[model samples]
Target chain A: MTALPASTPRKMGLVIDLDTCVGCHACVTACKGWNTENYGAPLSDTDAYGADPVGTFLNRVHSYEVTPAEGTPFTVHFPKSCLHCEDAPCVTVCPTGASYKRAEDGIVLVNEDHCIGCGLCAWACPYGARELDAVAGVMKKCTLCVDRIYNETLPEVDRLPACVRTCPAGARHFGDLADPGSAVSRLVAERGGMDLMPEQGTRPVNKYLPPRPRDALTATPAATPADPSTEGLGGFLGWIDRTLARF
Target chain B: MHPAPSIILFTTISGLGLGLLAFLGIGMIEPTGLAAFLWFTLGYGLTLVGLASSAFHLGHPERALRAFTQWRTSWLSREAVLAAVAMLVLAPHAIGLIFFNRPLTGFGIIGGLLALQTVLATSMIYGQLRTVPRWNHWTTPTLFLISAITGGALLSGLPFLSQMLLAWLAVAMVLHWILGDSRFAASGSTLGSATGLGARGAVRQLEPPHTGTNYLLREMAYVVARRHVVPLRLIALLAACVLPSVLLWIAPFSLPAIAAAILLHILGMLTARWLFFAQAEHVVGLYYGVR
Candidate 1:
């Protein structure tokens, strides 16, 4: 086995563009597929097409509609998963070392063999990322597709991740954020991205670019023209409109 | 969060063990059923041994003696100490019941005190976790009391009293779930409070400290799907409370029914316990980027 490089103090991560995301759920499906196939254990569903079906998934999309006082209708779809925090409370709380963050890539992975199926890691996460695999009796989560990204056999263009590769909207981006010149780093820098639930202080690696003005997509409504024949009626209606507006 | 099976078993078994012992002590004054006494003592002994076996899950089993040091603050310590005391009192009381054929006046009182201590200590285990808003409540103590009393009554094999206890347990479960859900909702909002800032504080996450998963996420950041929670909660209530109550009522004095009630209670308790931890919103949750 090729040994990983020496531990470095600095950690790298992803920056997601929430504004561009279309809530396709492709990322969620991609993550599930990749992890189930390659992770330490398979993510099993009791009944895929039957009643009372349950399984493990690391990524999920939450769609919300936000109406600002001055803006048109806006819909925000936030695809949330693990933030891969630096001061991960989930790590320290584990009684066993089965749950640990890599000193190299900073990837948090569960040693399936060592896991006692104590669901403490799930409790520590604020993002609701981790889920228990009832069949395997271990915890499962987003690996950022660790196995796929580093495989030398894959072509360079296809080496990113299932989520990033399959994002039809191109909302998700993955790279070494430590390099300021990287695409993710530059996008975060120029777009003035915001982190979700920043107050939690877990220091989520992912960033969300806020939705831009809808004026870019659609033309603003022009002022209505006064009908010359209805001038008298318009005057009366304008007075009523002003009065109603006050209330 | 999926707690280790050992811990789950420990809490459930011990609750049954100590709870039955406490119930027997309460009823001992009335010269009632010898059969009830026999079943209660048997259940208590078995549960105690089961609870003790769970010690193997501890990383430092030999150092379990040190667990008593923090009885002042730690419910775990209090539980250890009280459980030991309960066993001591229970053994002598059992002997008195069998050999002395004497009125268990003094031993009964001692057993009662130990039972009370066990209930309090058991409650404290969850109640003391201030991080878990759902658990850190007065209702937790009430739930503990009800669980012990209900479990004890079921194991006693006394149909009528078991039925009554089962009904009380159903009410207790409902009250606990309602109160617990409300507490969870309240703490969910306090995700903002975790940053130690007031609700208006503008603290926002800019970047996560690490790239990959860590121990904290593995231990605390677990979530069950929202869709599953409601159904599971109802199922837990049915198994833990409703079914047991119905069984107790229909077959008030049946040993099979009583045994079924005990088994159902264990299942229900386990589900409730899982939800208890799963629903609990910790201040640490704020750190994990949840609101």
Candidate 2:
């Protein structure tokens, strides 16, 4: 085998634009569709198209209507999923070494064959990312499309995850987070992006740009039409006239 | 803390086994009816077998012997030792009931001690897990105590309080589940104790460590949705505690009620055990970038 040149570490992640996302759930659907097919086991539903259906979904969007300090009403659709943390507690708690992070690209993954179905990783997570495949007796979660992103068969532009590709509003961006010049890094730097539950200390790489102010995006509401007769008439005759006009 | 089924089976089975043995020894001193003795013995024997079978779920069964070595520090080890002691005492006590016309005064005392030890050891298993804030409380011990007392009481009063015990168990399970989710403000001793940066505000994530799921996320990130949690909690309460209690209360002295009580107590104890693991919050939650 030809020896390749030693390379420095690379940090890969996603930057999601909260301002532009329309809460379409396309990314959620794309993620579920891709992961259900590729992950350790299919995210099977016990009673799909029936009462009380249950299954694993890798990504979900939460829409919250925020009335800020200024008292302006605006809706912010927050798409929540696994924020792959640097100090992942899930990996440390696994009695089996099935849960591990890659040193090369900072991608954390589970070796399904090594998993003993202990569900320890499920207990160690706080973001509700991992789910147990009760049928296969193993754990499952989002891979960020590890297979597609690294595949040489796909074009460079199409290397992003299915979730990123399917986002209709261009809210999701995937790239090397370590490079200061990368689009994600620059966007995070410029927009003051935030991570969900940062106090969790998992050091999640995904960034969520805060929603833009309501006034900055929408026009003010116009004044309501006035009742012209109300100001002019005050007596019984005016009431009679108004009643006649109503008839 | 999703209660792994193996663990649920282990704790519940063992709890009933130890609990029934304790009551059987108590009944010997006071001379309860022959029916009570029969039911208690049956409950204890069944639970013993169930607990033994649960040993198969462990990763290293042969090394289970090594588990006894950690009695000074490990509740699990203590539980094993106490279980063995209970078995020893119950064997002689059962023999006396069957063959020897002699009363079980001596063996009963030993059985009581063994039962107490089992309950304490079981409580300590969860109480000792400092990483899990929910399991680390006095409530854990109280829950274990309640399981033992209620299980024993049901077995002792068989055909009478079986339903009531089951109902109490159901209510206890609901309370346990609710308490499991309510977030206590970070105190000086718990998950918040690590940072000591008491700002008295909710901590939101500013950044996370990586872009992919790791072991901590996989283990700790499992969440029971609001919709499912309520119904499951109710089912666990009804099947495990409430229904049994009602059946036992209305039809006390009935063999079917006694049977139902034993079955429901076991089921409730298992649900309670599952919730015990599921609701626990680890100190590692501190490292998840939370305050």
Candidate 3:
């Protein structure tokens, strides 16, 4: 089962825009809230109300400061999760047949019941997408919100992934990446979406839209004050114009 | 890599065990009756104990048996199956020698070859990992094979073979270190490449993903200072090969010298194995700004 299917019916994935993300962590919190309750295996925290708290969550946002050669430094909030790769190394490396990609949707997932938690899947994943649940003794990762997305009982509008639904900036989009007609696909085409590390060769299903060009107009320089008291005839005219503008 | 004590113990001890067994299979070790029994017993002991310790390293030890189910795909599964086959063959071969006074026969030779194959499979488990560039090399299996054979040769007290294999082991060990150092220096990953920020020229992490240490940091973000490696490598070389070979040379005259050589070699191998795991930079560390 760890050997991937030759073809999947649909590659369900996410496309996130870096330009719009404000890094509020709403999506991170929403993902935690939804997955902990929905999945059969709760992503447990080792110490919920202790001095040093640590828990297993599928998605984590990494903040990085990038300084372009000619421009000012800017921070990019990189939210990483299981990319549901076309060729997921995690699935191939699983010895117990626990880690697998769904043939129908291409959503890489782990069957907790069968996982030995050897941590092989984690090592295989360069993205650090998978983590071993120390409490449950199994590997865990982003399940693509499989429980919620396919649930017919939920309202149609609310049937998307918890992260996508809660993204206040509308930065996150979820749909079938295999279909070029999907909204996520169109968004990818328009924004020139990219993969995290194409060199690693995971062939990720998810795409990321790069940050927009930073304009000096928005990041304005400090203003030098003009002393109107010591200049020529134009100074009194400028002062009059400035005084008129203030009025 | 985390440099888990159990794994270090497993590879080192098992390497020695299978090395000795390989000598037995080739009809190189000369022993009669109970001595032969004891020799086989000791070899199997190291292999099994080392294997058992590795199994214990698993998060769920009870599910360790399920690892054999995916031999066709997983390297771990291949190791399990090959090791099991070696054990099965070795049992009867050991029985024949101990009870029936039979010298090394067809089955015994097969058992020895299987033992060597099992060690190769074990080495392949790490060597096949594309994530850890340091481990993904030809030197890995070469080092494993040479160490096993040399250790076995020493145990057999075969003076000429021991001398030759010890020399080969030394050469292989040095090659592994030199190649490994270069591999570390020339790591294919960079902070820019890992983050898809190569075009930006320079990237820095003002804030990490988490405030506290997480599983990735604990498991993959291990770093060893450069200052410690050179001295340690020299120590490993002296203990594992140089002194062991010199002691093994003296072993032809002194009956107990072989034991001393084996002991010193094991210590050296332990140090070397620790470096192996500690030095392995998993490419995932790129995400944490570690090169």
Candidate 4:
């Protein structure tokens, strides 16, 4: 049961735009809130008010500074979560049949009931997407909001993943990546989206659109501004200017 | 690669125990009655103790029985199954020697092979992890198997075999360290590649995901002291291979010498195992620029 499906009917995943993310961590908060309340286990925090607080989260945001060969350096906000790879090593390495990848949607999920909490799946992940809940004693991961994606109870507009729906920058997009004609696929094709650590051979369903090139100041001379006229002879100002002129 | 004490003890102690059991099963030390009982008890005791310590590393040790169900793909599951089967097969041979003074060659051979395979399976658990570039190699398994064999040969009182294997193990240990040192660089993983920002130029982490440590950082992005690495490697090699080899060469059958050799050997192995986990560089560290 831990073996990955040969192929999925639809690769439901995210296409994150690095150029648009503002590093506000809104998506991270939204994901934490929705998943803690609705998903397998409530993402518990140990010593919430103490000096050191450690908690399990399904998503996180990181910021990096990129220095170009010919342009100025700039910061890029990076939000990371489970990419739900087609060849997910995390699922297969599980000793218990707890972690699994869905053949229907290609979403990787963990069955808390079956998990032994060996943390091997977390070790297997290259992206650090899996986390072991300290209180729940089970592995936790991004489910891609499996409960909400197909839910008919909520309005159609509110059916998206909490992260995507709440991202203030509209940096995250979700759809079937398996379909070449899907909006997510089209966006990937148009923006030259890339897979993180492609050499890892995970074949991640989610793609990241690289940050666009930023404009730098050109090395050209600019016209000088007109000299300030000392025509307004204020009492103190005029005396100071005249005294300096004597030198 | 945090190098948890429970894991270090589990791997090193179990490897040594399994190694000794393999030798005992093959009739390397022909003892009967009380002697056979003592040796078999020591072997089983060490193996069980090592295994029991590993349970503490698990978040839910009570559900460990479920681990046996996934041998089809998981190496950890295969290790559990192989270790259990090995012990079961060796049980009858051990009983025969202790009660009937008969060495069951057929059962012994089968059990010996299974016990050795359990060491291989144990090694594969770490080797199979591609995320840790330093461990994802054939050398990882080779190192583990060699250590187990050498430790087993020494414990079996085979002087010539112990000396030879110790020399070989020394070479293997040095070679493994040298190769492991370059694995992360050779892995072609960088901050640029991890972030998919290589084309723009060099990528460096400006800020981590959180101000406080998280599970990923605590578990994978460990940073061992660089200054202590060389001295520790020296200590491990000296204690594990060099001193033990000298003792065997000088006094092939002295009781105190064998006792000292085993003690030094275990100490050396513990150091080496600790280094094995601590030195490993997981690819995920690139994301935080930890390496």
Candidate 5:
């Protein structure tokens, strides 16, 4: 079961734009909120109210400062979750048949009941996609809001992953990346979306839209120094009077 | 990359147990009466105990049997299956040695090979992980197998074989630290590459997403200071490898000398194995800015 399918019917994934992300933890919270309730078991925290607190979360927004060669360095917010890789090491490295990718939708998930909590999947993950529920001692990750997306009772617009729905900046996009004409696919092509570590060879399904390029660095403009004879307020007043007298 | 105590003990104890089994299978040390009873009890007893210790590492000890299901892909599963097979096959071999006066050549051949194979499979569990570039090396397995063999040789009380294996152990450890350990800094991965920002000159974590230590940081972002690596390497080499060889040279004269050598080597390997897990740089550490 750990051997990946030859191909999935659809490569369902998220595409994120780095340019507009505000580093708000909205998506992170939304993901935690939804998955904690809807998933088979709650993503638990060990010491929630104590001085040292740890909770399992499916997604996180990392803030990175990128210093370019020429321009002033800028900070970029990166919201990271499971990429649902085509060749997910997590799926292959699991001792139990607990962790798996759906052949129908290409969404990777963990069957908690079968998980022995060996944590090998965590070791295999390059992106840190999986987190252990300290309370349940089982692996948990982003299910791409599988429950809501497929729920017929929910409104179509509201049925996306919790992270995608709750993003105030609309930086997150969801669609079938395998489909050339899907909005997410078009976004990937137009913006030159990239894989986080293409060399790691997870062949991640999620694509990241690179930050839009800006004009090369230009020197900061300096204010022209005042002439010695006409620098003060009286000089300006005299110039103003001369103009009035001429009128 | 954090070396959990349970795992450290499991690998160390289990390696020692399996190595003893390997030596016994090869008919290197011929024991009689009480010594034979001691050897078998120690061999199978330590093996089982070490394996039992690993169950403590699981979140649900009751669900540990489910780990046996996946051998096609997982190295962990393969390790379990191979370990089980080695134990099962060796159990009867132990019975034959204890009950019958004659050795079963067939059981010895198969059991010895399987015992060594189990240790090799255990090494592969960490070696195959691409996430930790420090561990994904040939030296990792070589170091593990050599350490096991050296331990086995020493405990089996073969003074000559112990000396030779001690030398081999030193070579493996040196090659492992020199080639394998050094490759981490030289690896092409950078914070930029980790975050898809390689086009930028430099990238650093200004602020972590969460204030508290998450599972990723707790589990993978373990950091060892650069200054400590050398001294520890020396301790591991001198105490674990060379000291054993020198002690084994005098072991023929004094039993205490051989015992000292085994103790020193085990201590040394414990240090080295601790370093093995502690220093492993998981690519996920880049997310936490520990790499």
Candidate 6:
């Protein structure tokens, strides 16, 4: 059961736009809020108000400073979660049959009932997407909001991943990536979306659109200094300065 | 890479116990009565204790039986299965030798092979992890297997073989460390690669995801001071290999001397195993800007 499915019926995943993310952590908070209440186990925070607080989270936002050779350095906000890879090492590395990728939707999930919490799945993941909840004693990961995505109870507009729905910048898009006609797939194609650590061979379903290039640093010329002595002051303030100088 | 005491104990002590079982299963020392009882007891006792220590590392230790079910793909599952099979198969042989004063070579050979397989599976649990480049190499399994072989030779009181293997273990460990030192850099997992921003420019962590530590950082981003590595490696090599080998070679073949050598050897192995886990660098650390 830990073996990955040969192929999924639909690769349901996310396409995150790095250029649009504002690093506000709204998606991170939304994901945490939704997952803790609905998922396999509640993400618990140990020592919440204490000096060394630790907790489990399905998603996180990291800011990186990129310094190009000829341009000004800029900060890029990166939100990270499980990519739900076609060849997910985390699922296969699990000693118990708790971790598995859904054959229908391609979403990787954990069955809390069977997990021994050995932390091997967490170690197997290169992206640090899986976290062992201290209170629940089970591995927690991003489920892509499986419950909300399919629930007819919620309005059609609300039927989306908590992160995607909450992103004010609209940086996150979710759909069936397996379909080339999907909006997510078109966005990836147009923006030249790329995979993180492609050498890892995970075949991650989530793609990241790189930030667009900023204006050239050397485009603006240096401004010349005004000749203060040659052009005498002609305003009321200048007259006051003359009087003060005479005194 | 936190070098948890439970894991260190499991790898070091369990490897030795399983190694001893491997040798005994091959009928290396066909003892009778009390001697057979003591040898069998030590072998099983060390193994059970090591396994228990490993179980303590799990968050849901009560659900450990589930680990035995996924041997089709999981190395950890295979290890549990193999260990159980080895113990069960060897039980009858052990009993026959102790009570009936007879050797069951058929069962002994089968159990011995299973014990070695269990050790291999245990090593593979770490070796199979590509996320940790240092442990992903073929050298990982080689080092673990050699350690078991050497420890088994020493525990079984094979003086010449143990001495040679001790020297061999020193050479192998030095090579393992030397090769492992460059693995992270060689892995090509820089911050830029991790973020998929390498084409743009050099990348550095400007702000972390959280102000306080989380489970990922605590579990993977463990930083062992560089200055400690040299001294610890020296201690591991000296205590585990050089001292044990020399002690065995120079000292007479007596119970007290052998016991002293074994104690020193165990001390050395503990140090070595500690370094093994502590020195490993996981690729996830690149995201945290720690590697």
DockQ of each: 0.03, 0.03, 0.58, 0.80, 0.75, 0.84
Candidate 5 or 2, higher lDDT: 5
Candidate 1 lDDT over B1-291, as tens digits, reads: 435567666777777777677766655333334754565467567667755766765433454565554454345556777877777776655666655554465766687668768777777766755456677688888887887777776766666766677677777777777887777555544533332222223444433433444444545546645448889889888998789888878887677887888788889988877776566655544554652
**What digit string (tens of lDDT, one per residue) describes model 2 on residues A1-247?**
0111133277677888879988888998898788777746776666666665556666766554444444445555666666666766556544445666767776767777666554545545555567666466567777878978997988987678888989999999887877899989999899877765554466676777776544453656685667544557779988888898887
Deviating ranges (above 4 Å) for candidate 1: A1-8, A49-54, A92-95, A176-186, A189-192, A198-201, A216-247, B1-13, B16-132, B136-291
CAPRI level of candidate 3: medium
Q: What lDDT score goes with residue B39 in model 1?
A: 50
Which candidate gets the maximum lDDT versus the true structure?
Answer: 4
* Every candidate's chain B TM-score: 0.86, 0.80, 0.95, 0.98, 0.95, 0.98
Model 5: docking quality category: medium
**TM-scores, one per candidate:** 0.54, 0.56, 0.92, 0.96, 0.94, 0.96
lDDT of 5 by residue, B1-291 (tens): 888888888888888888998888778775655677788787777778878988997988899888888999888888888889887777666677777755666777688778888889889999998888888899989888988888888888888888888888889888877787666666666778778887966898999989899999989888856459889989988899888888777665578988898899889988888888888888888888886
lDDT at A150, model 1: 85
Clashing pairs in 5: none
> Per-model i-RMS in Å?
11.0, 11.0, 1.4, 0.7, 1.0, 0.7
**Model 5 ranges with Cα > 4 A deviation:** A215-220, A223-247, B224-226
Give the count of colliding residue pairs in each prediction. Answer: 40, 52, 0, 0, 0, 0
Candidate 1 docking class: incorrect
> Tens digits of per-residue lDDT for model 2 on B1-291?
545576777777667667777766755334444654575566577567756665655433443464454354335556777877777786666666655544476787788668868888777766644445566566677777667767777666655444555555555555556665553333223322232212222323333433344345445534454336666666667776777767766777787777776676677567656666665655545544432
User: Which number leads on DockQ?
Assistant: 6
Q: Which model, 3 or 6, shows the larger TM-score?
A: 6
Name the 10 consecutive residues with the lowest summed lDDT in model 4 chain B: B218-227
Q: Deviation in angstroms for B113 in model 6?
A: 1.1
Task: Candidate 2: count the clashes.
Answer: 52
Looking at candidate 5 chain B, the ten consecutive residues that score lowest on lDDT are B181-190
Off by over 4 Å in 2: A1-8, A216-230, A233-247, B1-7, B14-291
Candidate ranking (DockQ, best to worst):
6, 4, 5, 3, 1, 2
Winner on TM-score (1 vs 6): 6
Model 6, span A1-247: residue lDDT tens:
9999999989999999999999999998999899888857888988989998888889999999999876789899999999999999999989999999999999999999999999999999999999999988889999999999999999999899999999999999999999999999999999999999887879999999999878775656776677445237778978887888887
Q: Which of the two, 3 or 4, has more DockQ?
A: 4
